[model samples]
Target: MPTPSVRRSRPAAVRDRRAAASRPARREPLSTKQVIGLILGGIAFLLPLVLDVPDLDDMGERMLAIFLLAIVLWVTEAIPLVATAVLVIGLEVLLVSNQALLPVPEDATAYSTFLGALANPVIILFLGGFLIADGAAKYHLDKNLAAVLIKPFTGSARTTVLGLMVITALLSMFMSNTATTATMFAVIIPILGALPSGKPRTGLALSIPVAANVGGIGTPVGTPPNAIALGALAERGYHISFASWMVMAVPLMLVILIGAWLLLIALFIPNGLGIELDMKASWATDRKAVTFYVIADCVILAWMTESLHGINANVVGFLAVVALLVTKVMGGEDLGRLSWPVLWLVAGGIALGDGVGATGLDAWILSLFNWGAMPALVVVIVMGALGLGMSNVISHSAASNLLIPLAMGLATGIDGLEPVTIAVVLALACSLGMSLPISTPPNAIAYATGEVTTADMTKVGIVVGVIGTVLLVLFMPSIWGALGLL
Candidate 1:
């Protein structure tokens, strides 16, 4: 027995170290997806040169096509987004060789457009928000917060869903919708899983997305479309602040939530089928982490709201990034691993806008749409419809980044509707939970729980999404009238 002891199997730490060193490097043979990604990547980078597309001045049309191909790969997720972005860089090289895309007639210059995207204020804001969320998770405050917050609903189904919706809506005022959902998931989904109570009746399924949608509406940074609209409008010198955004956004959220309540009641839940509130004391076990994260969130909110003197919205976001660096919530290496592809895509979109502006094509595109002469309400309806459809087809971020500039260009021709605001309303509403599984991340996230089906979301979401589109069109004019924002 002593001879066979073998020193207790080399101890857990030693065994772990040896096992890690001896590990077979995962040996992931190229998968079909990877193969496709490589082929497409090669085409995107190599095709423009062979095709002999000539670059006229700084036209960069070939680069644009290459970028499109790269984005297609990204959206398909055949490869990682960053990889797709790198493919864009490589294509930039080929396009430059043929003198078809590079503004500076060189590969390095092609990166100017892309690097511009990475350096933007909004992209940086995403980084800051992630850092804050990371700090929140590190201390396990998210779980503790959820445990304490979830205790209040007791066993009632409707109340539990309602509580989550309300909390998500409130938290989303300053955070991105995705980040808010991720945070809320940490707090809420576990409770859903642990329920000896079981999955929510049919009412529980629809209610979660409804709430998530409502919560996401009230903040400038809750979704990208909101940011795009806000940024484009601000570029035209319209000074919409956090408070001003909420003054309008709050009512929009209220209308949608009311509709959701009615819809939920009409479906599975009786008007009488209600949930009871819990009076249990909270258990925020990671009190220390919560303290750090909350302070950081407050700082961000203050900057976003411009509540403090000498600190504006854009300035605040950068400060948060700096805080992330100084506090070591995440390392530089981790930051390097951030979604730079999406960042580059944003840049590509913005550069496209800049390109259009430079070429006087923005004016031409606007004139073609002929949307400038339409009534404000008509424009609202059209923009809303376009937003919902395009978001469902592509992605919301893509639609806004691509379309808002065109709208901004056309605004000069309109008499009443502020081009940027209409764009904002359209862009902000882009994250609707509608018919397709691929429409929005929230739809996918909630659907993947396997508790809800795509068809269920589609049936209810179509009615609700259409209703939401109408709500925005009708409400914007009324609220803007009251606030004189239009």
Candidate 2:
């Protein structure tokens, strides 16, 4: 007969085997898109080096090669996004930086100029935001807040979805869009399971992602593209404070969120259906949870009052990071869990922008277009549209990374166009893309629930996207002008 310990060990081993068997296998073969990306990326990288272009210097040619390679790789994701980002940094250092293996230009930047991107002020700001967001999840504050705040909208299905979207947007303004969607869905899944499947289910499922996506536009730390834009603008000496970003974006975010809610209700939710969610709140009162709550509130307060206190948002963000770690509310595991990939991606964009400006690639690219002939508003509108369309097919951050530096370059040359306005418009437009499952992580989450079909997301996404983009392009610039935000 086996001993009790032996019997327990056998079951544990059996369970581990079962878990391994259930896991999905990685695909070793490249897809058609990736194959094309790899081939074209190589060709693009070499084209600048091989062909002589008018007035572009050797360093400019090298930077152009790096730029083209980035475009292909980012759009098709032949390599991981972060991989391409680091590649950009490495290429800049090797080809254009003062440490270049091949020398030509007297104005080559120091390698640290590229490496320093990893620690950009915006990156530091995002680090603090990530820590606070992760702490919220660990402490159950997000879910519990949802449970309590969702009570008034519980009686009717439409009202319930409105409440759900409102809370989702509120959370997304502070948390990452993906995290907000996941947190809301965790609470919503049980309710979804309870409901009869069909349009009502689809409507409820779609609401969370739409709200989360739009909510990300509400604050600077809400999404990666926002950080990319901020970093690029800061490099150009145009600074928008944390509170100022919210003031500029939250109004538009609310409009889009409400517009999406109405559209979802009109299209998917039946007129008479009602939804009931479990509203029991289980607030955590432990010492660690209490400490986290206090820290989060203080950090948020400091960010919001930057104009009053005269403290930089980056410093406030770092302060939060130090406070949480010093208090031991978050330890090594939490630090390790921060979105390092996203940070790297943002850093890569900053470095790419630095390289472009430093190498005069921006001037060469600007020479290709008669941007002076076009109306300043038209230029911004075109860039916004490009951002929206590209982000629909690729990663939003990638779209921003490719567009922001060029847009900033255009801003300098165009009369009556501010770099801040164009940059903000581009970032906001990227956030508006959610027409397909792959458009955003939040949309992907919704689609993965198996409730929202591609067709379902497309119809809603197109209408919402169009409405948001039109309003953003037609009205936002003038509004910002009137408010002196620019």
Candidate 3:
């Protein structure tokens, strides 16, 4: 017979086993990629500190360290993207700002200047956009609008795919690509299930992400890369208003969206297969939802008519936030649901660009290349290609952050290269990078559905990305100049 202590010990062991079984599994603290990134990032950070480059000052060296560390971390995602962003700001304050721990120049940037990036105008605009998007999701406005708008294309499988693509793109223009893809997928999952599991399902799955990714290029608030470009341009005293961005990009967005739709139909969608969609729209009728609708419309209108009201877009964005909070349309929970990490990520880019410009790092880096010898068109093509290629493997905002400052520097070095043209090209090119599941969040979401294979996404993505980049590089600038859009 067992003693009392032994019996008690057995029960305790069982309890421990139960507890272990009930708890969620924990991931390793550092992945192999993360470990490699840390090692490489550390070396990159210390290189500028230990070795002096000719004509590069102390401040530039510090910023260079931060920039190099950022590249490695963002590429490998050793840490969260937002964490890297905040780190950049913190380092700027400690190493190069007016409050530097080391000796500094008289014109060192103010610490407040680095911290103030959190409230940059681009961030304010994104805050309003996030609030409105969240409210739309909460009120079921996005789904209802998509359902109602997709009715005409329900006649056939091909047309229904087109309709879905069109609605997805339209929503993505106003909402984040990830959100738009999620909302559309949620509505269409049943339809996708009803169809045979093959090319048709794959095509339908692929359409949402492709449309969302392409649609993001349509406006300033459509994507983070656009905000990155806008923030950089603002630093250079060149303001491209919301309407102006639409004027410059909507045509390309339409072209690419339609092309992708056609490609999807040809590749995966089979003809004569009828797709029956339940197109009933149950629009919200309650008082709170109605109030939200009014606020969103007014905010978007104000953003579009900045030329008429003379109220800065940033101020208008804040107005929307104040109106929503004051009216109780969105409470504390809704505010908490906003994409705070994204906002911080954009802030970090702004701070990074500011630091690079302040330290003359842009000129030092630009001096390494003979940009003036290249034709303006070739330079633009190269910048666009870099943005497109880098965005495929890293975060789109990260790609923009790394490239836009350099593009600005190139604008100064190359004769006849307009900052507006190069900056806009780089921004839009970043949006065109969706050739893989890892290219963008929308693509990742689409791949997660298990309806499409990586090969499926890669083939379509490569075609769309290449075509879109070619159009953007070879023709858009001429069109913008002809229309006086620049």
Among the numbered candidates, top lDDT falls to 2
Between candidates 1 and 2, the TM-score winner: 2
Alpha-carbon runs more than 4 Å astray in model 1: 1-114, 147-155, 182-199, 271-294, 304-310, 324-345
Quote the positional error of residue 356 for candidate 1 in Å.
Answer: 2.7
lDDT tens string, model 3, 252-281? 999998999899989998888887877688
What local lDDT score does residue 370 receive in model 1, on the 0 to 100 scale? 64
Q: Residues 146-252, candidate 1: write the lDDT tens digits.
A: 55666665555556666666666665655545555666664555555544342344456456655666666676656666666765665567766666777777788
Q: State the lDDT at 304 in candidate 1.
A: 55
Question: Candidate 3 — which residues are off by over 4 angstroms?
Answer: 1-27
Cα lDDT of model 2 by residue, 252-304, tens digit: 99999999999999988877787667679888898999999999999999999
Ranking by lDDT: 2, 3, 1
lDDT value for candidate 3?
A: 0.92
